[model samples]
Target chain A: MIELRNNELIFQFPKVHTQAVCRIDFQRTLRIPDDNQEYPLPPGLGSFPINHVDDFTDNLPATWKEHGGVFIPMYQAEALWMNFSGHYPCAIKIAAGKINAVSGTQWTKKLSNRPQDYVVVPDQPWLDGFNVSKGCVRQFVAMPLGEGYTAEEQLTGDAEHGGIQIIVYPMKHDVYVKYMEQHRVFNIGDEQCLTYAPADEMGLGAGGVMRQEIYEDDYGIDSWDQTSGLRCFVHLTNSAIYQKITGHPPLHKPPTAQEYTDSGLPWFDYYADKKALQGSASLSQLTSVAAKKIQKGEGTLDNNENVHPNTIKTIKKGRVVRDGRF
Target chain B: MTFSSYIRQSREGLKAQDRRFSVRQVAQRIGVEPAYLSKIERGDVAPPSEGKIRALAEELNEDPDVLLAMAGKVSSDLLAIIRKRPKLFAELIRDLKSMPDHAILRIARDVRDGDW
Candidate 1:
């Protein structure tokens, strides 16, 4: 089952496991400039408020009613990152408009380690964008789908769906308990119909590449409770359509990279030397928002350039380090 | 989420699945006045006692421990056990807090399997 609390989507599968509840918050952040530069992670300006689409059935389109899950407003060029926290080890599968963020393949119900279509958490604290390379991901920039820039349209060449789709398969109770007894570590519902119009709406597109890592699963394939999982569709509504549907403008408009740089807030760099997963060979071909905008020449960027790379804060990995007597 | 929001959403979620799980019916079944339960749901009043929380948890099919933890209360039964050796239990918890979850689980297992 899925529950929206404090602007976070909480997913749990009671029959599968009791303690496994995952909370995902969509974080609004500065859109890193797509200047072919690898940048650090950006600060979360705020979380966009999420509401159930069922609550606004009267105003939403028929397609939205058919895909009943949740909705969040996003600006034209705004960037977003998914922040994940949960009680147990689980496999999180992410897709942008039905395009897998990890492997850039079509959405699948089963967990596949052949190409590693999902990321394991709490090793993966946040996902910024499409995992294009081993240690870098293109930032998730919100754009109106169907212009052929989003990872979805670029991969499938069709903008049938315009939102983020997430499926969480938590560890089985026995496996989690046994693993906890041995190791102390850490430690979801149904799907909906699959029909959507190609009408222009907010969808995530590949943007600037950032330094991040998607860790390989440690629990092995059989550990996940394949019998049941929770899947949620997070619809991304563009500003105007969102206003017409919700009867109010978006609560927060995330500052652009320029405004954020001027304010002197810190961008971050996380250091972890763990083995990383290989990125999708197909996902590497998608274009960033800025690069695509420059090619199309229809819209202008919101002064998202001129970044100061030296000002970024480097976060050392939190592993226990030995201090030899000196 | 806070105690109030968690209770409200869980109730609403169950109500969405089964309309029989209404506020008034639930409040009456849990042995509290509808208005008081409503106030608790709205955060106007503090959460009820452990008995009420356990009853509500059973009614909503939720883990009693989760609800009790959200309400910032320990289960009375567990409290009674702790009260038996308060100082020793307090020290045990203080040390357990710093250890990893597996270590604590190991301690619990050893104690449960120990000869009385």
Candidate 2:
């Protein structure tokens, strides 16, 4: 189970009520197209093997599409929530043995606070390393959505109120590594895995035709006004076994300055400040007055009344106004 | 030759033929610093040597002898054709001069057929 603490909003996952598991099955093997060699794996689950001998002509497209497979458990989603929030500062410590005997048991205790939202993998380090006397393990802690909303809400909130649907994919590892390298922090280890995040549309399966006309009809609704549905995926590994066998970090790179900058950290700060101001404004009588105007087909104006003529024209044309006036 | 003599000859040659090439345009075609080309044009620096003249010819898609004449060197027949219809000839000449010449011939044929 992962423990997430974000100011007043603390949530834990794979809660006692949920039996969520994070499993990496190494027995699932696919033929390496390059040499027609079969390899037991979990490392290349989301990517094509870079060193394979065959020309990537045949395998690249399939590997690119299934870059990351989809299987959602409640705990993974909760961890993603923490990642998106940009609030919970995270630190992970994995032990070679069982989680109960780990040095960071105190941190694990906090996982009980919001148990329903998390899943704690007690022996993740050992399990990840089971293959080579050392298995790969990774730990990631991120502040997901600063506003404390779920991934679904962040994604579909726009669609709920005649807004655009923004599909978000997980981040990729190469990009994460590049960011880490840019920030000059190449050695911080396994707590660094990147997941893909899609920007606008979700993928459809075979025989599922997406209705492009529906989007065409509602195309003007501002997608930027909606919140982003971003989830971070953490790859847990066994450090001792991984280092002895492969001479590399189980994780890619820890946080770097570039990663912090590229991760929209500055934008989050601005968003947080803007939200605080908006919250303060909502508490005033002005909001009630505005609501009344909205109810009566009257449009609200901003602080600066130097409105554009085009805006005025649009407002007049909208249902909120009548007779070329608001 | 001296820088001043070279610049004077270049300017006289261009003016003698009533050519309309801008220094900026020449610099852009030849991939040289505009400021450096400007200095040479203004007689502040020498006109480029023969090798540099050939390079400029290659860049501007003109005959090497015409470029040498432009730099106040020997004149050539190609220079006369270029001077007649600078824009059209420049386009035609660039197409003729590019490596793997058949591609340009095909495009020219396409243009003639109004398929471009």
Model 2, runs deviating above 4 Å? A1-113, A116-200, A203-326, B1-116
Give me the overall lDDT of model 1: 0.75
* Local distance difference test, each candidate: 0.75, 0.25
Error of model 1, residue B1, in angstroms: 36
Per-residue lDDT tens digits for candidate 1, residues A1-326, read 56666787766666755667777788777888887788888887667777667567677766776666677887787788888776567788888888889988898878798888887766777889999899999998888887877888888888778788777888777888788647776442221111111224667889888988888887787778777755556688776577778777756666677777676777887676668888889989887787788789866566666587555776665531111110
Estimated TM-score for each candidate:
0.68, 0.17
TM-score of 1: 0.68
Error of 2 at B81 (Å): 43
Best by lDDT: 1
- The sequence of per-residue lDDT tens digits that candidate 1 reaches over residues B43-108 is 999999999999999998999999999999999988977897799899999989889987676455
Worst 10 residues of 1 chain B by lDDT: B107-116
Least lDDT summed over 10 consecutive residues: which range in candidate 2 chain B? Answer: B107-116
**What's the lDDT of the predicted structure labeled candidate 2?**
0.25
